[model samples]
Target: MKNTTTPPKIVALALLVFVGAVMLGYGVSRMSAQEPQGNPVTGGLLYDKWWTVTGADAPVGDHPLWATQSTNTRTGADTWRCKECHGWDYKGADGAYGSGSHFTGFPGILAIKGQPVADIVAALKGSTNPDHDFSAVLDGQALLDLAVFVSESLIDTAPLVNADKTATGDAARGQAFFAMCTACHGPQGNAIYFDSFEDPLVIGSLSSDNPWEFIHKARYGQPTFLAMPALYTLGLADSDVGDVLAYAQSLPGEPALSGGGLLYDKWWTVTGADAPTENHPLWATQSTNTRTGADTWRCKECHGWDYKGADGAYGSGSHFTGFPGILDATSKSSEELLAWLNGEANPDHDFSVVVDEMALDALVAFIQQEMFDISMYVNEDGTVAGDADAGRSLYAGTCARCHGADGKIYNFGSEDKPEYVGTLAVDNPWEVFHKVAVGQPGAPMPGALALGWTPQQIADVVAFAQTLPVE
Candidate 1:
């Protein structure tokens, strides 16, 4: 009893238990944190990209890091992103970025995972690495959030994804999970295009080539696209994210268009194309549609919105012009349609001098593949045969933004002789159907058909719109 000094092993064991208890207690405290924690997903997004998150322009020139190296060859916004220097792997050049277009001679920050969160925050603020200052671009909270993500949230992603960028998770589960993504990304991830006309990238393409980058962006909602929600913030676990990634990677890739449908709707807005300096040549041929300039240049103007030409919407109205519709011509061979477009069949109908072969082909493809007859949905009495209930909902989301809630927003005619959307839908539904399907010429109204709305859905909205204020 007098020589009762604790053994060295007992002391070590007690210390181990003490450390474990402290860590467990700390973990519980963080889990039960009463104050609002910053959005680490947004932090990750900021790490991958700061300007997009902040909705600011690229930091008005080079980032501080760009002066440090000249070999990487990136500039402006690319240099400002934390991952540009650190990396999507968080390993910077020391890992996946060690060799590639992204290779920067910067060291990876993965070693800082277990480092003190405060220390990480300080380093980002340039307290340690003088050249790595991010305070100019990010606020304190953003910095702390970024540090919290780097120190506590970043998981090792290599094992979760294969070299081919396929996720190791269950794709089936991801498919079900994809429903949440579709509200914005769309059913096929084609709702939004990510790049320019010549080089386009959609969500499918982005997820396929750079699974790591996709994972990073997916976890954090896109900075510029504020509507996109970060799944991580929605309580998804790492495996859950991997599942979504797996499904996204498996999806097909299709560029929305090089400018086909829009050109079909109205051609001048695109680059290298000049707006009509004079009324369209066809304008002199008819005076029913009183508008001039680009409006006259639109294909929908000559071919009624119904594509029925003098046979449909514009058949008897003041807007009528003695032009033929494209319905019959649609059955013509591509060569025949191309010939028609090139003025081989109709000299006055020629667009050959205005648009090049590629543009002309796109227009032809649109006419051949997309232009549909409206007679199926529009009864002769002008009553829409679509489900009005479904149409009401579509109207709220897509149409009500321009038209008022009661659908009386725009009076496409004079006050004494008004032409409300309801008037158009109820009295001239054939016009409504064509306009809705192809999009209104000269207006930025979306072509419901091109936007993936079903014919029935377009009918529904048109029917519902008929119930709006006609007076």
Candidate 2:
């Protein structure tokens, strides 16, 4: 009772304790009410192209921040992609985009790595600069994802990739990983042509020229191509991605022979021309093949898929014509081949009226460089002269994925007839050899030629294929 009335210090201490407790309770309440964190994988994809993932129409005009950069000549949607300004390496002007056409004098998001996620979210919502805001185009969840990606998923490619655009990992390990990619991009990485036909571009060239871009695309799936797998989601480590890039850089450049092989199958399709309505000038010479109009104009229709014409697979079928095979003609010079195509050798066989000069040159290359004498690997009875045991492992690695273990997943012929890989291997080994070496026309099947496989290796795959069920 004596001290209670005079203890102002104790009273002040009691008041401070009450205020501190109230503040702690409020902080916990705010933290508990915050939105759940976003997915970094989805965030990575969004960083590539948000509209594609969201199914929203791309913003009609340039991003507000785009006006601040004049070095990059790109406009509209391209100007808005985060990678366009910050670079594929995410180091902006300090990285791969420093001097190229993509340079934009912008800073990278790498500096924000490991920063508070909430702070990044605020910055994305225009807390820092109004021009940097992406709130109008993305919802709260999407913005959070972008922030999470910036804070958690961004890796400094500097240590992984060298200054000379080479990967700093083991290429041999990378080659094992590349087998998964062989289905879409052939073994030499030239199955698809990214640029114009006149000046084609393939993965081999792309990786060597821009390793940073290659690393980005390899980690995340391609922007518009949904079928492409993202290695990050597949559990590939940073070192693993670097290894794959190193192997890919060693692949062959420009696919001239592959392009020519496609032309040999259907010239009009490869050239993007409308098929001629009229039959070929020489169509009247062949009565067995009833196919008329555009069918008669295909190079394969006359020369055969094996390039042996009447002497090979097309000799006795409904596809038969008295036409001579072009295998022997492979010995002719480029000038002679051009003369035959242009009607100098035979006016009726002239193809210059349909295909251009460049196409003719490609045909010449195919005949001289790509064509193989199938008789060496395939016997007359449709059996392969190869080691089936040796081929088993090769086929399992290369052909089994698409064709299936039994080689019966795809039916090349009618459903009732059901022509599978086994059926073709047994019935038309010559055709098989040709297709195996040069790949299927307009299909994703990797050819042994593009894979740098030996003739014996191809023969081995054929032998293993023959052992599968024909039914």
| CA lDDT, every model vs. true structure | 0.72, 0.78
User: Best candidate per TM-score, number?
Assistant: 1
**What lDDT tens digits, residue by residue, belong to model 2 across residues 127-166?**
8997888888899988887888888878788877888988
TM-score of 2: 0.70
Model 2: which ten-residue window has the lowest total lDDT?
Answer: 1-10
For model 1, state the Cα shift of residue 372 in Å: 1.5
TM-score of each: 0.73, 0.70
Q: Write the per-residue lDDT of candidate 1 for residues 97-170, one digit (tens) a residue.
A: 88888887888877888788789888988888787788877888788778888887786787778866678988
Error of 1 at 51 (Å): 2.9
TM value for model 1: 0.73
